[model samples]
Target: MYFERAHISDEELLSFYKQLLYPRMVEEKMLLLLRQGKVSKWFSGIGQEAIAVGATLALDKDEWILPLHRNLGVFTGRKMPLQQLFHQWQGSPLGFSKGRERSFHFGSRQHHICGMISHLGPQLSIADGISLAHKLRKENKVSLAFTGEGGTSEGEFHEALNVAAVWGLPVIFLIENNGYGLSTPVEEQYRCEQLVQRAAGYGMRGMRINGNNLLEVYHAVKEAKGHALNEQQPVLIEAMTFRMRGHEEASGTKYVPPALLEEWAKQDPIRHFEGFLQYLHLLDTEKISEIRNTLKYEIEKDINEALSATSPAVSIADELQDIYAPAPSAVPPPVTTPVAEKRFINAISEGLRQALERYPNLIFMGQDIAAYGGAFKITEGFSDTFGKERIRNTPLCESAIVGAGLGLSIMGYKSMVEMQFGDFVTCGFNQIVNNLAKIHYRWGQNADVVIRLPAGAGVGAGPFHSQSNEAWFTHVPGLKVVYPATPADAKGLLLAAFADPNPVLYFEHKALYRSISGPVPEEWYTIEIGKANIIQSGDDISIITYGSGVHWALEYAQQHPEQSSYILDLRTLQPLDYDAIRTAVAATGKVLILHEDTLTGGLGAEISAWIAEHCFTSLDAPVMRCAGLDTPVPFAAELEKNFLAKTRMHQCIQQLLSY
Candidate 1:
C-alpha cells in the first residue's frame, strides 16, 4: 500500500502513484535518448500526468482509450508493458508499428488503445462511431477520446460531439486544456472563457475542472461513465492544465512566458498531489523518495533493454508488405445463372442489402441514406428494411462520416460509407488519405470500411457533382480502389470489398447508374478485387480502361470490327492485374489507355508507363492515351460534350493504328 486519504483506499492511491511516476520517469529517460540522438522527438507530458492517470484508471479494461502523443500517463495507467513502450520510442522491431511510426503514434489492439494520426480532431469522430457500436451492441462500455484544447477548434470536434449527442452514444470527450497549443496560448485560440461551454451547443453535458486535481478528474470520469452506460449520454470534460515542457524537444521554452512558467510550476500536479498525501499522513518523505527511485530504476532498465533491442530489419519487401490484409481463403466462384437484369444503382443497393443480411455487424451510413435513400436513391428502403440503427442518415459532415466509419471498423464492424457524389470526397480527404488509408500499415489494424463514391460525368452534373476522382485514391497506398462498369461487376465487387479486410474505395460511375443494365446474380456473390475482365477479345489493338471509359472503349471496338480491338476493363485499379494487362499487350501489340479523368497524372498514365517499361518490346507502336482535358469539367453542355466525347477516343485510336 502506498497512501490513503479520505475516501481513497491505500491500494488505489498506490496505483495512482505508480501511474504518475511511471510516465515522468519514461519522459525523463526518453529525453536522455533524444540528447544522445537515439530517439528522434519527445512530447513530454510532465505537468499534465494527473488527468491522463485519473481518467484512464477509471475506465474498465474493455473500454477503449484513444490518446494523443502527449498522454504517456494513459499508457502507463493502462499497465502497458514498459519494454514495448520503450521499443516504440526507440523505433525497434518490437514496437507496435514495427518502427513504421513515431512513439505514441501507435495503438495496441490487445490493449484496446487506438493509434492516433498526427491530425488530432479526427479521432473524436471515430470515437463516436466506436461508442455508437457499443450502444448498438448494448455493451456496458464507454470510450474515452482525448485531445488538446486547441484541437476543439477543428471542425471534426463539433461534428463528433453533435453526432454522439444526437445518437445518444456512450463516448466521453476529454479535452486536456493544457494552456497552450505549442507556443500559442489558449486565450488566442478561442473566444470561449472555458472550452467545456461549447458542449452545450452540441447538446451534451459539459464540465470544467482543475486537471491537476487527480481525485477531481477521476470522480468526473466515473460520473461520466455511469451516465454513459446507463443513459447513453455523451459527456465532454475540459480539464484545465499545462504542459511543463515545450511542444517537442525542438520547440524550446523561448515562446513561453517566464513568469507564467513559474506560476504553473508552483502548482505542479505531481508535487501538489504529493503534498496532499503527506498532509493526510498517507505518505512520508522516505516512502515517496523510495517510490520515485524505484520507478526511475525500472524505467532505466527498460530503456537499456530497448536500446539493446535491434531495429526492424527493413528491406524493400518489408516496406511493400502488409499494404492490404491477407486475402480470404476461398473466394466464391461467379454465379453463371442470372436471376434478373438490374441497373447499376439497383445492383449496388442489392449488393449492400446482401452484405447487411450476411454480416449483422455491417452498417450503412451517408447523408439522407435512411429515409431519403441518399442523393441517388441507392439506399432506398434501407431504413425500413434494416432499421434506423443499421441504416443511418448522417449529417452533411463528410469527414466525420468517414472518420466514424473508421472508428466502427476498429470495433470489428463492416461500415459502408457513401459520398453523395465522388466529388465531395475532397471534404473528407484528410480522414481518407491520412487516417483511414494508413491505419493498417501504421498499427497492424484492419480498417474494413468501404467508401462508396458515385463518380464520373455524362448527365450534365458539372465539375462538383460529376468528377472521376479514382486517381486521387488509386495513387495512395494502403487503399484498394475499385471502379466497376457493369451492374454485375458492381454487385460482385461491392460484396467482395465488404468481405476483404481492407479499406476499399468503390467508385460507381453515376453515368451508368440508371442508363446501363446488365445480368446480376440474385444470390450473394463476390468477384475477386484485383482481377481484370476482357469484355471483348481481339488481336489487332488493346484498349485498357475502367468505369465509364469501358463503355467508350467497347463502343469504339464494336464500331471498328475490322480492326479487331480487345477491351480490358480494370475492375480494381490499385492491385491492378498486371498479368492480364501483360497478356493483352503481348497479344495485341497496339495499346491505348483511356479514362474519364484529366490527361495528366491520370490512372491512364500509370497504365501507359507500366506498358512502356514492361511490355516495351512487344509494342507494335507507341502506347497512347485519350482522356479528359487538363481542365475542370465544364458546366456548359457543349464544352462537357467535347471534353469527354468518343470523337477524342476515335482520334487517339486512329493515330495509334496509323502509328
Candidate 2:
C-alpha cells in the first residue's frame, strides 16, 4: 500500500530491493569471516539496512554523504566496488585507505563520500562545509551527514545543527535512532520524546519516520532533499529503527531484551519489504531465494578476491613518505622590490589580503571575523572587501569551525581559521589533531587549512589568553608549525604557510603584534617554511629561538655586546632547519635554546635532544635551555616576569658563554 502511494516503478522497486539486500548479504558474509578469524572486526548493519540503502539511494550520486561505521549499505548503494570494500575490511594494500584504516573509517572523494572518524559528531560540521561549498558555487547539491541518537549529546552536534540553520545551508542531518548507543538506551540518552524535536531549537524543519520501512525512508529522505535544495535550508530527520544485532560482531546482544528483540523481529525490514513485493507480484518466494543465492555467490567471489589481495608491507620508510603530500617545488623566487617598514600585525593583515586576492577558493572562518573584524581586528576590513561568504563570521564553536575548514579543504577550498587566542585552540584540538592532521595520511586527502594562533606571554593577559601552545601541534606529525619573529617573516611565512598543501599552525605572538616593526617586501613574496634566519652572526654562543623568544635573544645580545652570540631565529618549528641549526652550533660550539612554552616537554627539549645526538662532537659545552617555568602563566606582572624565559636569558647566556 505504501509503495503504491509512493508511485515508484516496479522495476525501480525491485532494484531498490536488490540494493537493500546486497549489504545484508555482505554483512552476513563478513560475520562468517569474523567468526572464522579471517576479518579483524565487523560493525553489523544487518537490521538497519533499509535506512542506509533508502537514504543513500534518494540522494544524487554527486551529492556528498558522511556515513557512520554501521552504514555499510551507504557504501554498497553508492556503487563502491565490493571487492574494494572487502579489501578495505581485510586491510589489503589495494583498499581505499591502502590498509591504513579499517572498516568504513575511510572516505573516497571520487565517490563523494567522507567517512566518519571514531568520534561521531565532528562529521556533521564537516558536512556543513561541504554544503557551504555547494551553496557558494550555486550548485544544486545537498550533503547528508549521519549520526546516531547518542551522538546528539556531544557539543559538536549542537554547534553543527545551529551553524547549518544559521547559514541556511543545503544539508540533510540524518539521525538513525536505533534504540541504543552501544548498550545505553534512549531513555538514558535524551530527555525529549523524539530526537527530531531538537531541530526546532535550531529553527530548522524536522521529520520522524519508521526507519525499518524501506518505502517510508526512501520517500522521507527524497522529500527532505527536495526541501533542502529548493529552500537552501537544513533539515533534521530522525529515522526510528532497531539494531537487530549487537553494536559489532564481537559485542554480543546480551544487554538487549529478548522480548524487544522478538517484537522487532516480526517487523524485519527485509521480510516486510519482500512480503510487499510478493503482494504486488514484483517478487515471489522462488525469486527471492534465487536473488539471495546469486548475491551470496557474488559476495563469496569478492571475499575470495579480497582474501587473495596482498597485505600492506611493513615499511617505516614508505609510511613516513606517505604521511605528507610532496611539498610544492614550483615556489616563486622571492621578490627583491622596494620595502617598507610595517608592524607585524599589519604585515600579517597584508599577507592575508594578498592571499585572498590571489586564491578565490580561499576562505576565512572564526568568531566575529566578518563585520566585527575578529577578536584582535586582524581581519578588520576583510569581510567588507571579500564579502561575507568568503570571510565568514562563525559561532563560538571552535570544533565545528575547524571541521568545516577541513571539509572546505576537501572540496578544493583553502581555509584560514583564526583562534581568538592560542589557549582557545583546546576547544578545537580534537578536530585539528584527529581529523585534519590524520586525513591526508589516512586517505591521501589533503587538508589545506591554516589555523592562526595568537600566542605568547608578555602583555599580562594571564593563563587563559597568553599561553604559547604551539608545541602541542608541533608534536603532531601531519601539521606544519610556523612562528615568525619580525614583520618580514610574518608576512612572508604566512604566505608560505597558505601555499603549503598540508595543515599549518601559524603562531603570531600577541606581544609582538604591534611592538615589532621591520622592513617587509612591497610585492607578494614567501619565505621558506622550514628555513631559519640569522639575525646577527657571532662565534661565542648560538642563541637559537623563535617567536617572542627571538626578540629576547636579540635584546640580551644587545645588552652584552662583549658576548659574541649567533642569534638564530627559527621561523618554522615543525620541519625545523636542521642544516641551519647544525651550522649555528658548529660555528659557536656553545648553544642555548629559548622559548615561551613550558620547559619540560617543550620544543626546546626536542631541539636539545636532536643537537645532542647529531651535533655533540661539534659542541664545546652542553646544550642549555632558557624557557618559561612549568606553571600556569601568572596574572601579576612580577610573577609573570619570573614565569617567562626572558627573566632567565641573562644567566643562561652567561653560563653558556663562559663554558
Candidate 3:
C-alpha cells in the first residue's frame, strides 16, 4: 500500500485523515452560515485543505507560519480555539485583532501565526525576516510562507525569493498552484511551465507534488524543512491543487469549466484519504459519520458563542487608538554642555554606533552599508565595530528588506533601514505604508523599525535623488515623521527614534549632511518626539518650518533682525507639536509656513489648514506658505536655484511682515 511505502503507522495515518477532515467539515458549515446571513464573508478552502493541514502539521510548534486567506487549515491545524476563529470571522471583540480586522487578515503572536495583508507578496519578505531572526539567534527554526500561483507574478515575489536565496535564509516558500488567482487562470499568470522551475534561477531547491495526496504533501514539507535548516537555504514547493469553490462566496466560479470540476471532484482529499484508511481496515462508514457529526456539532457550538459576543463599541476616541504604541514617558534629560562639534552626517553615524553598542538586538540594513559604508557613508566602519551580521548589506530589494524589518520587530528586534537616497523609497513604498505602518494598528504588533531617509534638494543631485518626500509618509497614519536641521537634533532625534516603539521615518537633508555642523553631546541622549523646538524667539511673525526650511528661516531671521520672526522647527510631523504651534501663533499674530516639498499636497498645506482651523482668532493676517514651485526639481544649477523655495522665503516673509 502507498501508506506502507511511506512508513506511516495506522495511528499516524488515521490522525492525518482526521486533521484533513476537520477543516473540510468546518468549511462546509461556514458556507452554510454564509448562506444563512450569519457570517459576513468567507474565503472557502474546500479543495485546498490538504496542503495547509499537511504543511502546518509538518512544522514544529515554535516555527512561524504566514498564511494567506485560503489557508484556513493552518489556523485549524494549529488548534487555535474554534471560538476565537469564529469570533475573528464574525468581527467580534474577542478575536485576535480585537475586531480591528476581518477574516484571516489578523495575526496571533501567541500561536506563531502571521496573517497576510491583501498584498500577498510582502508577507514573503516578512518571512525572510522571521527566518533571518532565527539565523541571528542561532535557533534551528524554519519559517514557512504560503502564496498562490498568481501571487508569483508580483514584483515582491521576485524580490523576496532573490533576497532569501542570497541570504541563505531558512524559509520554505509554498505556492499552492490552485489553478486560479481570483478568477485569472494559471496560464495568464506566468509563461513558465511550473512555478517550481523558477526556483533554479534563485539557486534553491524546488519540488512539485500532488497536493491532494495528504501523505505526499506532509512528507515533502517535512523534508523541505530539514533541508532548509541543515543547509541554511530556502526551498520553493509548488503544490498542485484546484480551487473547487469560488475565490469568495460572492464571486461565483462560472469561469471554471464543468469538466475540470467533475474530474477534481473524484480526487477529493478527504474521500481519497478515507479510501486509503478503509483499505487498511483502519476506518469504516461508522467512523466517518461519527467524525462528521462531532465536527459539525463543535463548529455550530463555537459559532453560536461567537455570534453572542458583542461587536466592538464605536467611539470617537476608540477610532484613534492603537495607531502607535504608548510613548515612553521617562526620557533621559539632554546634556546642557556640548562635548564637541560634528557634522550632521558624523552625528548620525555616531548615534548609530552608540545605539548598536547599547542594544544587542539592534540591526542596520541597507545597500552598500557594510564594507562600502552606504551610499552616503553613514555606516562607515560599522561593519568593523558591529559584525557583518548586524550591519547587513542587502541586495537592491528595498521591499523585502523593509518587510524583513517588520518581521525582525515581530521577533523582538530593533531594525534600522537606510534608503541610500530617499527617492529610492518608492521601490519599497508598499511594504512601508501597507505592511509596516498597518501591522501595529491591525494586530497590536509594534513595528519597532526606523527608516533613515536621505532627503531634500539643493545638492544638484537632480530630481530622482533629491526629493523631500517626508510629506508622503507624514500623511500616512501609524508612522512618526522626523526631519532634523542641525547636527545636534539629528543625533538626538535618531536616538529618540530607536527608543520609541513605533515606525519612524527620519529624514536627513542631503544638503545638511556635510554642510551643516553644530555642538553635539558625546553621551547618548534622547529628545522627546513630537516636541517642537523654538530655534529663535521673536514677537512679530512666526516662521514655522522643518528640515531645510529651518535653516532658511534661521538665515532670514538673522539677516532681518527688525522683522523679529519666531522660528519654530517641527521635528516630528505625525504627532505634530500642536501645543507649541499654538504657542507660536499666540506669540506672533502673523504666520508664514515654509517647507522644501512642492506647494501642493505639502506638509505646509496641512499645517496651514490646521492653524486656520484652530488658531484663526489669534491670527492678525492670513496664514501664508512658502514652498518649492509646482514642478519636478531641475538638474541645471540655475534652474534648481529658481525651483527651490528658499528664494521665495524673503518675499513670503516680507508679505507676512507687512500684513
Native-referenced Cα lDDT, model 2: 0.90
Number of the candidate with higher lDDT, 1 or 3: 3
Clashes of each: 0, 0, 0
Error (Å) of candidate 3 at residue 648 is 0.5
* Candidate 1 lDDT over residue span 471-554, tens digit each: 898888999999999998999999999998889999998889899999888888888999999998888889999888899888
**Local accuracy of candidate 3 as per-residue lDDT tens digits, 308-327:** 77775766676588888887
Comparison by TM-score, 1 against 3, better one: 3
Off by over 4 Å in 2: 1-5, 330-336
* Pairs clashing within candidate 1: none
Ranked by TM-score, the better of candidates 1 and 2 is: 2
Candidate 2 residues 1-659, lDDT tens each?
A: 24433778889999999999899888888888898988899888778998999999899998899999989989998899999988888887788988889899999998899978999999999999999999999999999999999999999999899999998999999999999999999999889988999999999999998898898988999999999999999999999889888888778899999999998888788988988998889898899999999999988888787777677578889888877877764254355588899999999999999999989999999889899988889899888899999999888899999988988888899999999898999999999999988898888899999999999898999999989888888889988899999998999889988888899999999989889999988788888888998988998899899999888888887888887889899999988999999999998999999999999899999999999999999999999999999999998999999999999888888887777
RMSD (Cα, Å) of model 3: 1.4
Q: Write out the backbone clash pairs for model 3.
A: none
